[model samples]
Target: MASDLNIARHGPQDGPPILLIHGAWHGAWCWDGLAPLLAAAGFRVLAPDLRGHGESPGRKHLRWTGIRQHVRDISALITGLDQPPIVIAHSMGGFIAQHLMARGVPMRGVAMLAALPHTGALPIALKTLWHHPRTFARILTRLSLYPMVADPADAARLFLDPATPAPEANRFHAKLQDESFRAFLDMVALALPGKPARPYPALVLAGADDALFPPKAEQRLARRLATTAQVLPGAPHDLMLSPHTETTARHILDWAATLPPGAKPPATAQTAPQT
Candidate 1:
């Protein structure tokens, strides 16, 4: 199944590779707007629907799948590439990227957008439970992640900026699928990733108006990575989506220009074991 990931490839074959990782409940479709922009900027972009989301097949196993499995899937993809690709990871995907770094996976660089904090997502979970008791109850009863964004209003509030049109928000909500419940547990307590043993060029960008993880959480993540956070004003949790995608892409393009030219994959890099 490792070879069966639904990956959307774009741009020139010989261009520098840029791997785009979507967050929880989202899939490669979430990168629709941002991928084209990155490809146009001369990047060979690859966006994969992590198992159980989007076109990728794993629905039956989603309930048991965790973050470590997702990381292994990505590690395989990187191993197959001609050169180590720069990774652009968002939200939960950021955690996966951090895990790769911790395990000594080679990469040209990493840009984390609206990433979960190293301290874990317990605070976000508690805040959601306090603010949306009914929804939280549904999540608890069903043992599912969908309840949190089942309503279009809730989805818009959590992931989109207020400036986004209602129709667009509804469409985005419709596309959301159930995330791995086990992965949620891993993020909360079971397997919070630590700082990487080896350093690489890193950037953290967050939405100023994100309802989930706040700017301060992203700032903390940046500090751990030995970098500074850049908060995009009016942006929300889904940075690759509407209103601020171009702005997000511009920041990434600017950062990509600064990476060392012709960097080679490290000998220490190793492919993760297949699940």
Candidate 2:
């Protein structure tokens, strides 16, 4: 059965559609800063809370599911669109995007921000822990066995810029949810498939100071996808909610403008919910 995902939409009804996928521990709410900017640029943006995150209502079963389930949910949403939508994914969401493209989902283009490379998140996590074992040890102790939510301070340290306001960081941390352990394992176990026969345009963006997927890692991912990696100076892993949100949004707008047109679904009468 297809899970009913909670979607947040923005922009004109007839405008080109773009789908924003959030990363681990985040829901559709993470796109709050970027969605309006894209909409104002004359594009319809759709950000959906993946199953078990935000208002999607599958939290109880999340521990047993993997990335494939998320791929299935997103595929269904895209299949329902008027035309293939451009995809912008972040963190683990980037991993999801890669799989979608590999499966031949018709996307006009894809933009990955601080995304987990095809190399997967496990290696990155292990590397980061190796460099800062004590810090991660403390963070790990706070996580529950099943659905694990990192402590707010740990999340802030790993994802926010040092200059970010305390309140803003707190707000972002408060929205963090538990991620699926099975999904994490799946990401580590899954291997990247050969490059797509019909390659689509791709953009890779990294936070210069991202503790998770650093610039070098993102660059490697770009190389694999045949695209260059762009870096947001001093930003952290969660670029969408960071101080550089506008700058990141602008870059996405510019890249999205260059893609060739594809399927565009007509505007619906349903109004976007308040953010």
Candidate 3:
């Protein structure tokens, strides 16, 4: 199952690998903009769709998939890498990464972008219920997570800057799909991955105007990582898709540069084999 994961690769294959993990309802497509930016900076990038998302298989079984399975799937990918790759995770992807860290998965470092806090996602769920009661109701009634972002306006308002043009927001919404109800419960504390097995370099970042997770949440996550959060002004939940993407990429690059040497590019660069 892990070998079958749909992975999008970029940059020089032998260059140090960096894995990009997207949040709930999102897939590797969310990193389409940022992956190239990182790749151009001399790092190989691998973005894999979690099971039931994007081009990954098992969409019909999404309802049964949970964060635990996601952790295993991703951990397998990391183990298969030529070397431990730096991990970049967003939103719920960040949550899954936490589980990996707690379980001692090998990685050079991690940068959590607008990730869920260790405290759990109950607050986020409550906020969603308050702001989008109809959508929330639909989610419960349908036993699926797609209702939360099924509407373009709702998706834009929840995940993008308010100033984003409607058409662009709609296009973004179009790419979103159903997420697992069990995964949402896992995030809300069916289990908490706790802190990392040991301290490793980490960076936490968030958007100031993000409607879902706030700067404070990022700060809490940073504290857990023994780091501080960087809150970008006017940014939204989807920093990779927002106008702040370049800035976000720059920050990640700068952080990666400061890390103790990890994976190194081969003398002759080549693209990695597709997963």
lDDT of each: 0.88, 0.81, 0.87
Cα deviation in Å at residue 258, candidate 3?
0.4
lDDT of model number 2:
0.81
82 Cα displacement, candidate 1 (Å): 0.7
The CA lDDT at 156 in model 1 is 88
After superposition, which runs of candidate 1 have C-alpha atoms over 4 Å from their true positions? 264-269, 272-275
Supply the TM-score for candidate 3: 0.93
**True-structure Cα RMSD, model 3:** 4.8
Q: Per model, how many backbone clashes are there? A: 0, 2, 1
lDDT for 201 in candidate 1 is 94
Clashing pairs in 2: 13-267, 83-263
Report the C-alpha displacement of residue 118, candidate 2, in angstroms.
0.2
Once fitted onto the true fold, the runs of candidate 3 whose alpha carbons sit more than 4 angstroms away are 263-275
Angstrom error of the Cα, residue 240, model 2: value is 1.3
**Can you write out model 1's per-residue Cα lDDT over 1-275, one digit (the tens) per residue?**
35789999999989999999999989999899999999998999999999888888888999889999898889888877878899999999998898888877778899999998888989978987898888778877887888887878988888998988878877888898887889989999888986685898998999999999899989999999999999998899998887888999999999999998645565665674322
Kindly provide the TM-score of model 1 when superposed on the true structure, using C-alpha atoms.
0.95
Higher-TM-score candidate of 1 and 2: 1
Best by TM-score: 1
- On the 0 to 100 scale, the lDDT of residue 193 in model 1 is 86
- The root-mean-square deviation over C-alpha atoms between each candidate and the true structure, in angstroms, is 1.9, 5.7, 4.8
Estimate TM-scores for all models.
Answer: 0.95, 0.88, 0.93
Q: For candidate 2, lDDT tens digit of each residue in 1-275?
A: 23389999999978888999999989999999899989999988999999988999789887766788888888778867788888999998998888887777768999999998887777755864787676456545633222233466767777888887888878877888777767766776754434554588999999999978889999999998898999888889988875788999989988987888785545542211111
